[model samples]
Target: MILGIITDCTHYTSPSGEVCTENHILLRQFKHLSAYFEKTIILCPFGKFDDRKVTTTYTSSNIQFHQLPLVGGNAMKDKVQLLVTVPKWLRAFKMLHRQCDVVYQRFPNNLNIPGFIYFWLQRKKVFATYTGTWSGYQGEAASYRLQRWILRSPFRGPVWVYDEKGKEQGRIRNGFSPSYSVAEWEEETAQVEKRKQRIENGLTTYKFLTVGTIIDYKNQLAIVQACHVLKQKGFSFQLTIVGDGPMKAELEEYVIKNGLQEEVKLVGKQNHVSLRQLYREHDFVVQAPLKEGFGKVPIEGFFHGVIPVINNISMASQMIGANERGFLFDASKPNHLVETLLSLPAQQHLFAGMINKGRTYAKLQTLEAWAREYYETVSAYYNEA
Candidate 1:
């Protein structure tokens, strides 16, 4: 059987005919699906750019890419361009629906709206994965709310969601799962053990990390401010901010102007391997994002036994489990994070236990297992067809 995937993430084709993407997690998920299906076709926005500098690439002869003329942007001109290209996108989806046996659309993406509607109209075997906040629909964009409404309709097939609260959508079969791999869990365990030993030897400075794009919603500035508060309190800690985006300059200015250069470091984006190393050395993963879908950073941090000290949001509390596996602070108040960090040294004895429990939970959610579940869910629909 052939599988077709629709997503907003960009896919790049190297001169050597290799599929490359900046999203390593998506690439890995595609690779896992490739093993189960006879062939897989990824339908995403494509651009003709040199991918030689890109570190992550997926090279599989069985996997083919069907690039769509879907130039995505939020600007007014880009919106007009998208409207003009709607007819072309619909035609492409109709063709894709006929060619593939199963179609999987990643939700919360406007690019897939046309494809999803066409596939539903054709009565095709379609499944979806919603990797967004599933708690309350309030404050979300109208398009996002519309997508959620479509997924919840009785017409949609089995849907897998990252948040357990998504099960409330009783009209559709919603499954909850974490995105991780066995190799990742094993590496995290090793790192956690090494860090545990170092902590036992009495390390001086506590290392805290936050991984995500430097966006306003991500609230990297709040993290920096909290670090500043900690520094004022004479706490010996270092906060390393990873990932890059438009707000990099603004964040740098905040760090420099606040005289927090030594307390906070913006390491920019790093490859998967480099990130794994950082997770190993860091003592805690601190994030106060305004919103999150699945909170993959916390999961990745949990695997490495890096206790997640995150904001008290739906995704964070759900992933970390009521502060048992990790700590949670109020995102609305920056001082809450500072207070959480200050209490860490006093609770140092509880670190090993939390790490062990987190690793145990992460072990159960492997990519292999997720693929198996996905295959079963899709095969049921195929059988019905």
Candidate 2:
């Protein structure tokens, strides 16, 4: 069966960790306005490569969605651009509808009018995986209400959410019998598997790492404050903040003010390989996000057998599960974070145990496994109809 996956700008990468090529017949849908819901996908841009038509059978193995830009021009920027793009997008959707069997969408809501019409008209099955309520991003309460109304429409299909709470809401709010899915990571044992070049425990200090971009939403400042508390209380752990963002300079100042200059280091942005290796050197991982939609860093850390100290939020609560693999602090209460870390009985040893448990959990959900699940569900829905 030919399977077509439709998603927005966010879910960009493939399971194999390669940039999707235009020869892959990937189409990018563009949103018309922040207020209006019309969205359409035209042919992706190519440097020198030409657009390739999709086929039902995978016989044309040389085809790919190569060198296509992930985002079209901002929908609100120019009305002319939006008007011109919609027709091309409609044509692309019509082509895929005739060529492919199933279309899997990972968008959280029915905010794309063109996509909505195409999928609705094609009579092809639609499978969606949602993260959470878009209330925070919708600007105002009325905006969120409007979105909720759209989300509850009957035309949508069986949906999947990251957590049970979200899953339950999906059924009530979206007419979806939601399923739960986990992020996929490589399997690892409690101990780091030694390779050709292994670094001995030569560093005499405990190192902590926090992955993900440095932003206000991530609450890295809270981590720095916790480090200050640890310092005042005589705990001497070194922190390495990975990834870069607008909050870097402010966060650096906070680190300095708290007298943690010697302890905390902002390493800026590192690619996945560097971050993975950095995970090996660190004693644990920490995320202090104000809220999260499935924090993948903890799972990544878990794969590397690094104990993850996560904030107690929806995703973290679901992921950590009664503190089986890590510590969860009440994010509402900032002081609680400091107290929790300070109170750990033999912190390193407790962390090691958590790492083992977390690693085991991370192993089960492979990306290939997730893709297979998504594909099968879409296939069944299309065939049954």
For model 2, the stretches where C-alpha displacement exceeds 4 angstroms are 10-63, 66-84, 109-113, 133-152, 164-187, 193-204, 257-259, 345-349
lDDT of prediction 2: 0.57
- lDDT for predicted candidate 1 compared with the true structure: 0.79
For 51-165, candidate 1 gives per-residue lDDT tens digits of 3444478877788887877576779998898888888778778767878888888888987677776887788888888778765445888888778777877446778765656
Q: What is the C-alpha RMSD of each candidate to the true structure, in Å?
A: 2.1, 8.6
TM-score of each: 0.93, 0.72
Considering every candidate listed, which one attains the maximal lDDT?
1
Residue 186 error, candidate 1, Å = 2.4
**Model 2 worst lDDT window (10 residues):** 28-37
lDDT of each: 0.79, 0.57
